[model samples]
Target: MFNKKHYKFNLNSTFAKLLGSYLIIISLILTTSSLVFFRKYEKLIVTQEYNLSEKLLNQANYYVDFNIQWATSFLYSLYLDEDIYDLMFSQSSHYKKNGISKLKHLNLSSSNIDSIFIYNKFDDKFYSSLGSPAENYYLPSMKNIIYKSKNTFTDAFIPSQIKINLKNNNITKNIISIAILTSKSSEKSLSSAVILNLNANTFSNYFKHNITNNSNLFVMDNNGT
Candidate 1:
C-alpha cells in the first residue's frame, strides 16, 4: 500500500529546485558587492598617489627659489664693495697685502660663496680670497664673458669636469662664476673683472639633509655638465 518510490522522487525534485534558486541568488549578490568594492578601493588608491607626487614637486620648487635668492644677495653685495675699485686703481705691496686680508675675511664671513677673486687685466694676475697666488693658465672655453662684459654679469653655471689648478693643485667642482665688470669711469669701457665663485653643492646640501632620504638632488655648473 505504501508507494515508497513515488514519494522519494517528489522529495528529490523539491530539494533540487530550492538549491538552484539559492545558488543563483547568492552568487548574484556576492558578485555585485565585489565589483563595487573594487572600483571604490581603486579610486582611493589612485587619488592618494597623485597627491603625494604633487607635494614632492612643491617642496622642490620652494628649495630652488630659496637658493636663487641667496645667490643674488651675495653676488650683489660683492658687486657693491669699493675695495674692488681700490684693488684695481692702486698698486702697492701694502695695498695688495691689505686686499688679501680683506678678501680672506669676506670669504670667511660669506655663507653661500666659496671663494672670491678680482682679476686685474692690466697686471695680468688673478687675486683670490684663498690667499693662494692665482696661477696663470689657459682654458679652452667661452672667453666672451671675461673680455666683453661691461656690467655685473654672472656667467652661466659651468659644471667642473676638468680640475681647476688652485695653488698648483687640481680639483673638480661645480661652481658659478659671477663676473663683475668694472670701469675706472662710466665711459662704456671695462677695465677689470671681479669673479665670485659660488659652490652649487653647498646649497644642495642644505635641503638634502631635511628632505626625505629617497629624494634626489643635483647641482651643476652653467655648462650643464
Candidate 2:
C-alpha cells in the first residue's frame, strides 16, 4: 500500500495537470474564435470593395453613353444646317468661313464644349477653333472608322496619352476620346465625322471609391492594349 503522504502528493500533481489542460483548451477556443471573426470581417470588406468597383464601372459606362448621345445630337443639328451642306457642295472659301463661324458661335454658347470643327474630305479643308487650316488634317484610321460605321453614334476611342497641369500641384494624366458619324445624306452622298474629347479625370474618379489598401482595378476594351 502507498504511504498517505505519497498518495496526497500524487493527487495534487494530477490536479495541477488537469488545470493546465483546461487552460490550454481555453486558449485554443479563444484563438479559433478570433480567427473566425477576422475571416468574416475580411469577407465583408471584400464584398464592399467588389460592389464599389462594379458601381464605378457602371458609372463610367453611363458617362460614355451620355457623351456619345450628346455628340450625336450635336452632329444631327450640324447636319441640319443648310450652311454646312452649301459649304460642302460649293467648296467656296466664303461659304466655308461662314459655316465655321456658325460652328464657333455654337461652341461659345455651350459650356461643356471646348471646341468644334468640320473636316471636308472632298475639298481637303479643316475648319476649327484652333484657326490652323490644314489641307489634309484627316487621319486615315479615323477615316476608316467613319467609313466602316453607318450608325449615328460610334464607340469610345481613347487616346494613349493625356497630360494635365494643375496649379500648385503635380501634373496628372489620363486617356479619353470619342467619335460620332453624321449622315449628311441618306443615300450615302455625304457624311461627316465628329471627334470629341472627354474629361478623363471625371471618368476615372468614379473608381476612387473602389480603391482599397491592397486591391487593384483597371478597364480594357477589345483591343486589349
Name the candidate that leads on TM-score: 1
Candidate 1 colliding pairs, count: 7
Root-mean-square deviation per candidate:
6.0, 7.0
Best by lDDT: 1
TM-score of each prediction = 0.64, 0.62
Clashing pairs in 2: none
lDDT string for model 1 (95-196, tens) is 677676778898887667667777665665567776533322323222344654545565454333225677678776565555656643233433566666
In model 2, where do residues sit more than 4 Å from their true spots?
Answer: 1-12, 109-114, 133-225
> What number of backbone clashes does candidate 2 have, counting pairs of residues 3 or more apart or in separate chains?
0
Model 2 residue 150 CA deviation (Å) reads 8.3
Which stretches of candidate 1 lie above 4 Å from their native place?
1-39, 133-152, 155-158, 161-171, 183-191, 206-225
The TM-score measured for candidate 2 stands at 0.62
Residue-pair clashes per candidate:
7, 0
